[model samples]
Target: MSNHTALSTQLQHTGIIDAAKAQQLQTAASPWWLQILLGIAAWIASVLIIGSFLGPLLALADNNPVRTVAAVALLAAAIWLTTRKQEFLQQMAVAIALAGQGLLVYVIYDVSGSNDETARYACAVIAILLLLSPLNQLHQRASLSIALLCLLSLVSSAPLLAVVSSLLAIVAALLWCSRLKWAGFAQAATIKSLLEVITLAALALTLFGQCLLWLDTGYWLDNRLDMARALYSALGSVLLISTVFWLSRLATVPSRLALLTIAVVLCILLYPASGLLVSTALMLACFYGCSRNWYALCLLSMLLAISQFYYSLELNLLHKSGILALSGVTLLAAWLLLQRYQRRLV
Candidate 1:
């Protein structure tokens, strides 16, 4: 056969049409690409229209009834757009929601008359939007991460509150992630991917704060909030106890004992980072007790723990060395105990 005929046969077998048909196919594809371009243009157009509506409000130079109306109108339109089933509209809705949220925050920033409160209120607004919108929607749930970040931003002044917010985000993330165990929930691939990424990102963020220089963990630490320490410690002890109790079944007694000893050492490490260490350990223990799917959580926990311990300025080299030595001995003992118990009991 001629080269052209041979190529044609091969192409036909591969389910591709001849060059003549390729022209036709390309012509057909042009409209789809055009549609995509048009959709993008539409999204931009919607944003511009909303910006026009917000223009006068911005000139108001401050938050007032007019700005408030614009903000609410944009939000309501964004929400209304989300209910539209058309693909183009959905994309437009995402843009509108984001822009609307920004406008709302701007108004709030102006009304509050303080840039300091912006993070907290922005987080509050996003949280409200998340709860109001469909949890299964990727965009709505995904944006919640901004709020999680606002909480992390609080670490500079309110370390305890920051930790509390982190804890809350983790708990909420896990509760949502737990649904992934079932076939029905697992079918929503986009939702699952978004949730896992957001949750892990948030977890990493929570750990990131510990890398900072904390006043409570330094020699010249703030003694004013020693009461904060007392409260955190009390809660930490309860967490430790419950954590041990939960691990009682899965872990050998020696393993649990090792873990308990480590918890005690961490609590008295005279480092606020230790609070997170205990909390992370407890969270990991909970994950392991509840699901074998906790490998990611465990890995993240270990990584964050190592970072916190390593960067801990208050933990001198000698103290860090001692902690590591005890950890090794405890682990070795636990391994031996587990082996003996397994051989004897099982």
Candidate 2:
């Protein structure tokens, strides 16, 4: 063949191969329904195996070799099914669901006098792995659902494990949601889902701490207080980290407003009087810096008003000091709004 003809033929073959590969890639990515079905199947298999083995092992440790063997067999089958899928959605959903159910089973067994540290550690590791899996929207949603279920299960069976798992799940969900490149309702839905996880986790931790306190004993009280303090510290750290991340995601005005609101609430909930004053000052500074936006100025004014009212009712602050702070915030807000209106008219 002529050299020119040979080069042309080679190029044609390369193009054909590339086209075929592209088609194959598209085909490999299955529909969301199929992925969801596969995930459900894997979850069912995992539950059957883990539940059979764990329940028998916990309740009848000596006489249930059959249940234990069956559980192992089922888990192996589920793992095999999960490994067969290379698609992001299928693999992630199946793996996360399986891992979540497995963790639930392990917690049940551990709390039932088995007291297996190894099992608990394994569950934690698996849960983390599931959270870290590469998945599309369907898989991420499945993973979030599974994680929430696991959180609820652990709450009743193992409070400490529940807290750790829930926190990790919340962080993972938020990270995953932030990476999603969706628009409109889809994006809003993902953010709402993540916020729900956070809210649930916070409520769970609070309830768990309160329950411990109600159990009654000096030792229990001391431990409960320590746990509450630890929880508050952890929440403060999360809020700080979240604020920093969100500042990058949010508009300037909304970012400042959110940070100010969060700081005020955190100070009231977690800090003493001195910390409250410091946080209030910080919020005032943030508001002042971002007062160009009317919405931000309005939010700041409302916050200041509430804070002043609460402070007056709760503390014997000098009347002049209270008056000065309130007056400053009011004047600043009025000036900002007037400037904004004038600019808009111009």
Candidate 3:
């Protein structure tokens, strides 16, 4: 057969050049400008409807109806936009969901009897939104979950709301685990999903710690140091486990560096003071492992050092003799490690 005939046959076998269906799919997908206009129209309609109808009705019931109505309206508009523009839905959904979350936080602050209650409800809403929105459909699951969690937290007593929020968190965790199991870690999408899950979990834990602090300042002070240490340890363990799994699947140097960067950041955030030592050591090790690449380690190390320095200054340790001695030793060790790696690379 001629080259042209052979190429045509191969294209048909691979299903890349479908002359009939490609044109139809392209036509069916809405243009970018049209999608934008539709989203704007939906947002306007939601605002008007909620402001004119829902706001007044809620106000009559002695609620801060204006803010509530606005939050609901924005959330509705986001759902509508997601439905009409599924192609670009992920990016748009995050923005709209965040706006909705902001509105909810404002409403919680304005309506709550105490700042502690407001904070608890705000954290709960944020955790639920982060857990639900990215994995499931915006309209079906995320909107429903947000609405339910908001009502439970804002309208219920503190004790009951805390229970409800904790339950919801457990549910979200289970669902996240199931998704991870089904979509194996080898997939790129799975990596993104796992990162989101870890972020939400970390935020939830921090908020839980804040709640403990708010309930009893004395108790918080007595236990916070230990709690911080434990939290950082847990975070470190998670990073080590995830790194092993990721390294097996990822062979490329850049991908490994990316994973290491994420692990380093998590360590810093989870335990800024103590994490400084670990993160510094990890970065140096990463640099050595990656063949003494200065460019790769520079940014990660600088971020960890800055955060550690800020935390140290905050704790009034800058003038302490012991801290200064420790800092000097740490720097010397890091420099030595760098030199050793540099020589090996040469």
Clashes per candidate (backbone, < 3 Å): 0, 0, 0
Task: Give the TM-scores of the predictions, in the order they appear.
Answer: 0.57, 0.38, 0.39
**Model 1 bad stretches (over 4 Å):** 1-70, 84-92, 111-126, 146-241, 249-276, 282-286, 289-298
Alpha carbon RMSD to native, model 1: 10.8
lDDT of 3 by residue, 233-290 (tens): 4443344435333443533454444445544544434343433333333333334334
lDDT of 3 at 162: 33
Report how far off residue 148 is in candidate 1 (Å). Answer: 5.1
C-alpha lDDT of residue 67 in model 2? 41
Report the Cα lDDT for candidate 2: 0.45
The best candidate in terms of lDDT:
1
- Residues 9-47 of candidate 2 have per-residue lDDT tens digits of 565577743544444434534588976776677556545
- Local lDDT at 300 for model 1: 54
Model 2 TM-score (2 dp): 0.38
Q: Candidate 1, residue 260: CA error in Å?
A: 4.4
Model 3: C-alpha RMSD to truth? 10.9
Score each candidate by Cα lDDT: 0.57, 0.45, 0.47
RMSD of 2: 12.8
Worst 10 residues of 1 by lDDT: 215-224
